[model samples]
Target: MIPSWQRSSQGVPRAEDEIASLKTQLSSISDLQSTRIGEAVAAARDEMAHGLAGRVSMVAELLTEIGGKPENSMLNLAEIQANLEFIGLLRGPEPPDLPTEIEALCERRRLIYDARDVFGDLFDRVREVLEIPEVSVTVVGTVVHDDEVDDETDEEL
Candidate 1:
């Protein structure tokens, strides 16, 4: 067996080296977490883009159907309301006290408002994560508006 002092001398350096390696690993993990958070923010922005596209498509379809034939506008409104429900923006059936068509349209508007609120909150969160000095979140807001315009143009075409 090795002498105790020699054994200790040999082990001390190895243990110190191991600790240093562990510290390096921890620092790497911290970097990875930061990267992941950035990726999540980008992903949230993409999701918001897709959601906005979907909402715009539903709105355009509703408008087109309404313009094409006034008599069947109620059906189009119901379809728009259904799309809103599919997206988790609206809840429950149309109230019996209100006319079905008007109620459906009202619900669609309410759902749009809710979706706007959700996107706004998400934008704020992503902005918080970015937190780049001197960078304004207004640019992000502008991009979102431009995306909406593109979607609207596509619908018009």
Candidate 2:
């Protein structure tokens, strides 16, 4: 027979403590996974950006070639190129909203984490001051097994 400290009133391991410990471990693992996934995404984006190099030059050369055609000589290549460059300049390299949106989301996440810490501290203080006895809980679950196995042909028929 196991000691009372190691087991709950129902003679099973204390489930709440085990569950809380598991949650903390899983949270750490998930945070690491999230960071790895984000890094992978950023790497993929960088690879894609590198692969797309020279595409703009290709477009510019094609446009210049088209303008050089005798029948299209009247078409102003300089003006067209200037317009394209102007459009590119107007975009101003990098979206203005993305950084601000990221900042706002980060701020919200910080607030949420701060609130969680505050609540956890409050709960700890209340429990400590009241000298409450922690309740021991045990989780029990069941699994069902099917003994009869049928072939795929039998199911089809």
Candidate 3:
């Protein structure tokens, strides 16, 4: 038999303490992993931004124009670019919104990360720290558990 301190009331290993510690570690690691996923998506967006570099230059030139009234010259170029982008949807550099090719590229990048494989890696990391040795929890004599209740039995002995 294991030591008394290692035994719980139900004669099982004292898992509550281990569970609490594991919960803390898991929450922190999960948050960090979540941030990594967000970073990956941001990287994908940045890669897609390269497709809009030319449009960015056009907008810059339009904004910097000083020869004519703001609306007339600026909007003329803007409207022209809009029409060009719409017509050249499947031909030239991409606009900001419709990321057809970019979306495929992002999916390709993400495809390498299979769900089963990613989760397997995560679980492997977690298990590396899971110390499930011969746990022995000593049983307490009292059965009092912390539950929200009112024992208003006035007829009690």
RMSD of each: 17.2, 34.8, 32.7
lDDT over C-alpha atoms for residue 155 of model 2: 82
TM value for model 1: 0.34
Off-target runs (Cα >4 Å) in candidate 1 are 1-12, 68-157
What is model 3's C-alpha RMSD? 32.7
Each model's lDDT comes to 0.63, 0.60, 0.58
The residue pairs in collision within model 2 are none
- Cα lDDT over the full model 3: 0.58
Q: Which scores higher on TM-score, 1 or 2?
A: 1
Model 2 Cα lDDT, one tens digit per residue, 63-124: 45434332322224434654575466559876446566557546655665665565555555
User: Which residue runs does candidate 3 get wrong by more than 4 Å?
Assistant: 1-13, 54-157
Candidate 2: which stretches are off by over 4 Å? 1-14, 58-67, 70-157
- Each prediction's TM-score versus the true structure: 0.34, 0.32, 0.29
What TM-score number comes out for model 2?
0.32
**Ordered list by TM-score, greatest first:** 1, 2, 3
On lDDT, the stronger of 1 and 2 is 1
Q: Clashes in each model (backbone N, CA, C under 3 Å)? A: 0, 0, 6
